[model samples]
Every structure is written in C-alpha cells, then in structure tokens.
Target: MPEYRRSLDIYQGYNYKKDKQTPVGYLTKIKVAGTDLTVDQTCKDPTNPTTDLKCVAVLSGALWETGVTDAVYLSGQVSAPNRQTLASLIINSLTSVEVVYQFAVYDYDPVAKKYYLAFHANQTDMNGLLEKRGEDLNVSVADDASTEVQSPINYSFQIGIKPQPSAQTLHIATADQKNVVKSWGLALG
Candidate 1:
C-alpha cells in the first residue's frame, strides 16, 4: 500500500551512548527490559517504513522468529496470560497476526556510537506472524534446526520471517525526528 523509490537516507539518530553491547548488522541480538530476547530480529514488513508503526505494550512477551538462511531469531519473555492472547488468534485459517512490529534495521557501531536505518518493516507488507506450535509440528527440517526454539522453557510459541529480496526492497521518505519517533513508537533510551 506504499510507494517505493531508489533513493534512501538511513537515519542517523541522536543515540550515541554505548551503555550496552548492541550487535550490529542483521541485528542478531535484542533485549527488552534487560531480559535477553531470544528470537532473531529482522524487518517484520518488507516495506520497512522509515516512520514508526504503532506499538502495543505486553507485560511479558516471548516473540518468535523461525527464519531460514540469514536467520533472524526474536525471542522474549511473555506472561502466561499474554501468551494466551496470541494463542486464540492462530485458530481456523488465520495462522498468525502481526501484533506489534515495525522493522527498522540499522548498521550500528557501539564504539563509534553511530547507526543508520537499513530497512523498514511496514505493517502492510509484513511476511510473518506469531504462531504457537504443537510438539507434533515442531520437528526439525533436514539437518537444519533451531535448538533454542525447541526447548519448552525457552519459548512457548514461534514465528518465521523471511527478508524480502534486494530487487524488491523499497523505501519511503521519512518524517522529521518528532513525527518519526511518534509514528514509529520508538522508545528513547
């Protein structure tokens, strides 16, 4: 539902603090509330809006990422009741839902204290949804498997997200910082 252009300006935000280690490129590591989020983080939507998407608050959420090739795993802590909220949705034909996700990738350097947006996962073009898997459906494929996701204590649900091809990648012009942060629901640290 959004248009595309070849020109892109990866945002260089005001964040320059090196308080903690942030894994650069592909965003392999992510944390919420000091807890190590276990899922691989990536662009939730292909459009990858420069502006932020609406964000909903969950008390404790263990988000999922079942990806291939450049695997982006996103795992977090979800309270039992919160987990139930997602459970009912993966019923009937609707296998999953994009609850609260807006992909904003960055090429960050902690030491240098600089970062830029690589892509945005807009709500309209997102490719994955959060899903709960039963033991029967949780078997490994080929020799490739996710040991972290297989453990019950680690996570109770799963979601797979695949990156869009480079040829298909598109960008939209971004708003100024206030509007961008507001629309993006980005929490300033």
Candidate 2:
C-alpha cells in the first residue's frame, strides 16, 4: 500500500459593519485531503488536557466560538468502478471520526454588576457520511506492480458558534473569560 501525507486548509469568513456590528462573529471552513482515511484519535476528556489531543485549528486574531458543523466527505472520483470500494471505505472510516472543540464563556450582569466566567467544550461524531455530494471518488492507480496505488479523498467542515454552553461559545468567550482582553487592553498603553 502507498503512504500519503494529509493536507488540511482552513478558511475564515467575517462580517464588518460601520459601527453597529459587534465585530466578534465569524465563520470557519476547513478542507482536509488525504488517502486511506482513518481515525487518528477519539474525543478527548474535558478534564484532561494532553498534547495528543486533536484540536480544531485556532487562527490568530480570531476566537473560535463554535464547534465543527456540517462535516461531510466529498469526492469526484467515487463514481469510477475501480475507486468505489476505496471511496466507500474512506466514507465509512470518516463517519467514525469525532471532532471536538473547547472554549470559555464570560457572562456579565449589568444590573447586578457581576461577571461570571466558565469553561466548556463539546464533541460531535460524524454520522452524516451516507449523504453523497459531487462526483464519485476517482484516483489514478499505479501501473507497475512494484508501485502502490495512490487514492486521495477530501472532507470539509463548517465551524461556527452554537447556543450557550456549547464548545464554540466557550472558545469565543475565552479571551474575556480569562481576562486576556483586559490585560491586552491595558498593554496597549
């Protein structure tokens, strides 16, 4: 079997307003490409923080306030007879993979003049692989017997804010919850 390296790309979308917009809300789109898909790691326990945990990529200057959503595998090579089985396998494996996010929340009560901070996280097992979009999986096979077949597949996700108590919300609120915002604000002096 041939070995392939995984390549991942993340894209972020934002909305800016003249003066009314909060300038805090945004969305993230992730694309992962690789071959012989398999689950590298399961969901991590929230109480335990380890280096082995798989975390959603955090971008600079932006707070990830949402868990991954709308995760799906897409391919243009699945329709090919030779690639169908591989595509099916990839899809099946991805369905078992779980993506999780960790974040913090900061709540302020103006009337009471009190502030509350909390940490939160959540995970979602990919169960929607059965839905197929775009062309079937297709990839070129090595002709030489000594050469291994190389198959590439693509998966995507939409990471965004959810309701309160969710991981996304926590992540978005981390800066405020941790008082990083206050520290940074003063550092500007």
Candidate 3:
C-alpha cells in the first residue's frame, strides 16, 4: 500500500472580556462552527507507473477544551464515485497524500482564566474497515488582561501512513498573542 501524509488547519476565535468576572467553576465551551476539506494529488505512485492513482482522502477531527466541555467532532469524506478507486491506489503504492481541513472554534466561556485546547483527527480506509488512525494537537491558553478578544489558532498535523497510520507531528499557533498568554504542543504522538 502507498504511504499517505495528512495535515490539519484549525482556526479558533472568541469574544471575551478579561475584566468580566467569571462565575465560580466556570468552564469554557469551544464549538465547531464549520469545516472545509481539500485534497491535493501531487504525483503518481513510483511503484506502479501504469495506472494513474489518486488518493482516497477523508477528514475527521474533534475539538476538546480541557476541564471544560465535551468534545465536538466533524468528518468530511470524499464522494462515493472516487472512494473505491482512491482506496485501491492508496493500498497499492507508497504514495503520499495531503489532506487539509479548515474548522472554526468558538469559545463559550471566554471569561475563564485558563484553558487548554485539544484537537484530534482520525483517518481510515474508504470502507472504514481498516484500523483507525488518529492525531492529537494541544495548546495552553491564559488571559490576564481585561479586554475582549477575537483570534484564530491554526493547527497542522503531519501524518505518516504505515501498517498503522500515525501522526508525525502537530503544529499549533495563534495570531492573537495578547489573549493567548501561552501556547504549545503538549507532545508529539
């Protein structure tokens, strides 16, 4: 089977006033506003030069706010017509496939002092029979200032496809530095 590489882009935004008093034991809730999926067919499989192979790409992921809300998930799959063909090609050659996902995060309790953002993704064969593969991306947030903020945090996941699909690394960053306070990947696994 060909190898595949998958990546993700998670955009997070919120409106919260730092000075606003938060109720005791308040929890921030991050919801999935919407999502978009894209696949780029870079090159042909080196092993088999005869058939023009295409990747069977599917995007599935979730957003989790630590100590706050339950996970909110989403999945995007390729159309039925392309599913079989792409799945066959991916199983034959070690082809690398790039899938990009765009999603938005809306913070429910923006006044919370601190919270952690956790993003996860799962990839499977077209039939959804293969072993489930996943990736996890995390970021830490703390806001001390008393200001309402709206920002986006982008997360990228590079996945290496093998007998068992595994995430190579996760990249997380935000443009709004004032509200972020701090952010980083918890671990690469």
Best-matching candidate per TM-score: 1
Model 3 worst lDDT run, 10 consecutive residues:
24-33
lDDT of 1 at 99: 31
Q: After superposition, how far is residue 49 of candidate 1 from its true place, in Å?
A: 19
lDDT string for model 3 (23-109, tens) is 111111111111122232222221222333233222223322321111223322333333333334334542223223232221223
Specify the highest-lDDT model's number. Answer: 1
Clashes of each: 16, 14, 7
Distance from true location, Cα of 113 in model 2, Å: 25
Worst 10 residues of 1 by lDDT: 7-16
Model 2's TM-score against the true structure: 0.21
Q: Write the per-residue lDDT of candidate 1 for residues 57-159, one digit (tens) a residue.
A: 1111122221221222332323233244434433334433333233343333444444444334432333322332542222111222223333222223333
Comparing 1 and 3 on TM-score, the stronger one: 1
Better of 1 and 2 by TM-score: 1
Runs in model 2 deviating more than 4 A are 1-50, 54-121, 124-126, 135-189
Cα distance off (Å), candidate 3, residue 56: 12
TM-score versus the correct structure, for each prediction = 0.32, 0.21, 0.22
Worst 10 residues of 2 by lDDT: 180-189
Residue 45's lDDT within candidate 2 is: 21
